[model samples]
Structure formats: structure tokens, C-alpha cells
Target: MLNEEIPDVPYHVNGVEYERGYYLADGIYPTWASFVKGFSCAVDKKRSYFTRKQAGARKDIERTFGILQGRWHILQQPARGYEVNQMRRLMYTCIIIHNIIIEDIGYNLAENDWVVEPVVRMQRTWIDRCDTRKRRTKELRDSEVHEGLR
Candidate 1:
């Protein structure tokens, strides 16, 4: 899922940058620059340790969505007799019940969640890291030799 953001991923971070539509549609972490940088910070053990941790904990929501699709195949089909409003209510109720079951199984997310701070203060950190990353791009030259070998 790492390169799922792009149709074709380049050897560098500047490659395969998504347009505004993809960012707007995705809804979570709206920018490719920010998204990649956050993961890179988590990769480098610099800052936002808690943020990265929170992101991981949030993966359960994704799993929950996947489970809903797998367990109830009706979601894909059209409404035959049920009202759309009632169907949404039923889905919400099921989600709530699922959360209860998850809680009962000793799987509390609050304790495990680590919230990363916003980048208001991390601008310098971001620039510095990006510089380091740019310097490290030299390693890619060996993989697939490009023309701009300055």
C-alpha cells in the first residue's frame, strides 16, 4: 500500500506527486508532501513519534470497514425495500455494536493511541529532513542511471 498513492512511483520523493483531486478525495492527511514527510519522520525516529503511533492505531478503523464489507455483502447491492435513512441507521448501530465487542475483548484504543503534534513548530525539521533526503537521492543513481549526473 506504500505506493498506492501513485499510478507510477519514481525513485525519489518528488516523483509521482498527486494532484489536488486525489488529495481532496482522500480526506485524511490531505497533502502528499506532508503525508510522505510524516512517515519519513517516523522512519528516521526524529519527531512525531506519538503521531505515527496514533496513525497505526487508527488502522483498526480501516480493518473495521473491511470487516463490514466482508461480513455484510448487502452494502454493495442496491436498496430493494429498505429506506436509505433506515439502512444508514442500521449500519451505524452495527458499528456501535462492533465497537462494544472490540472493547469487551480487551482492545482499548485510547491507551494505545499516540497523537503526533502538528507541524507548526516542525517546519525547520521538515526542511532539514527534506535536504537530507535530497542528498541521499544520489544512491538511486546506481539503481537506474539517469542523464542528469551532476
Candidate 2:
């Protein structure tokens, strides 16, 4: 998705046409799909292979998990003491934080940037927090991992 890709309209995937949406980079811009569950309008495939491929392609899930897991506080007790709104805030802030890190270093290692900041911040603001720092750390770690930290 280029910056010009949006008002993006409908586009074809495998000759199957569907509405295409923009994803904000680094906690800014309006993005499509709420950052909660069901962030897409595609038909759900229940197969493990499909899920893996999709997850792998999207890769945000992995990056988010990596960011969250990197922060022991977030990893251990993400929302244990937070209010409903605060919890929402925490989750999204973490997401934005997580996404920024990914964007900074993703290209040299991964295929695409999945964590859009507006979406991340929207989730954070709607919920109420931002892990801009945590996500950045994860990005560095990922870079190291790419260099064989694993």
C-alpha cells in the first residue's frame, strides 16, 4: 500500500475483486478495520494451512506478539489492573509501539509492514495508551534476530 493507494477503492486479489483500504504508518493517518478482532472483510478460512499462510503474509500478529513478549510487563500482565478503557488504551498503545518498531526495520528482514499507527492509536485512544518505546525495542531485537540472534 503506497500513500497514493488510497481512496484506494476496490482492487483485485487473484482476479477476485474486493475493497482495498489504507493502513497508517507509525501511529498516524486514518486506517481501515478496527484494530481489534476481525480487521478484514475477507471470507474466513478455517483451514490451518490457510490461517498460517495468511498470518504469515500479514505478519502483524507475529510482530505484535514479538513486541508484547519483549516487554515483560506487557507480556506478563498486559491489562491486569486496568479499567476497560485503560485496557483498551494499553492494548493499542502497545500495538502502535509495536508497529513502529516493525516499520523501522521490517524491510531488511520481513516482507511487509503490518502495524499501522492510526489503527494502533485508534485502538489505544479508544481503549486510552502507546508502546512506541516497546515496539521500537522489538524492532531492534528483530533486527538482531535477523542477524541470527535466534
Give the TM-score of each candidate. 0.33, 0.33
Per-residue error (Å), model 1, residue 115: 23
Best by lDDT: 1
TM-score between candidate 2 and the true structure: 0.33
- The lDDT of model 1 is 0.46
Which ranges in model 1 have alpha carbons more than 4 Å from their true place?
1-48, 77-91, 103-150
Per-residue lDDT over 34-148 for candidate 1, one digit per residue giving the tens place of the 0 to 100 score? 2221233344453457446545655665667667767765355555667978797867766776777789998886677545444242345767767756654433222222211
State the local distance difference test value for candidate 2: 0.44
Any residue pairs clashing in model 2, and if so which? 27-117, 88-127, 89-127, 89-128, 89-129, 93-130, 93-131, 97-131, 97-132, 97-135
List of clashing residue pairs for candidate 1:
51-116
Q: Deviation in angstroms for 27 in model 1?
A: 8.3
Scored against the true structure, residue 60 in model 2 reaches a CA lDDT of 65
The lDDT per prediction is 0.46, 0.44
Give each model's clash number: 1, 10
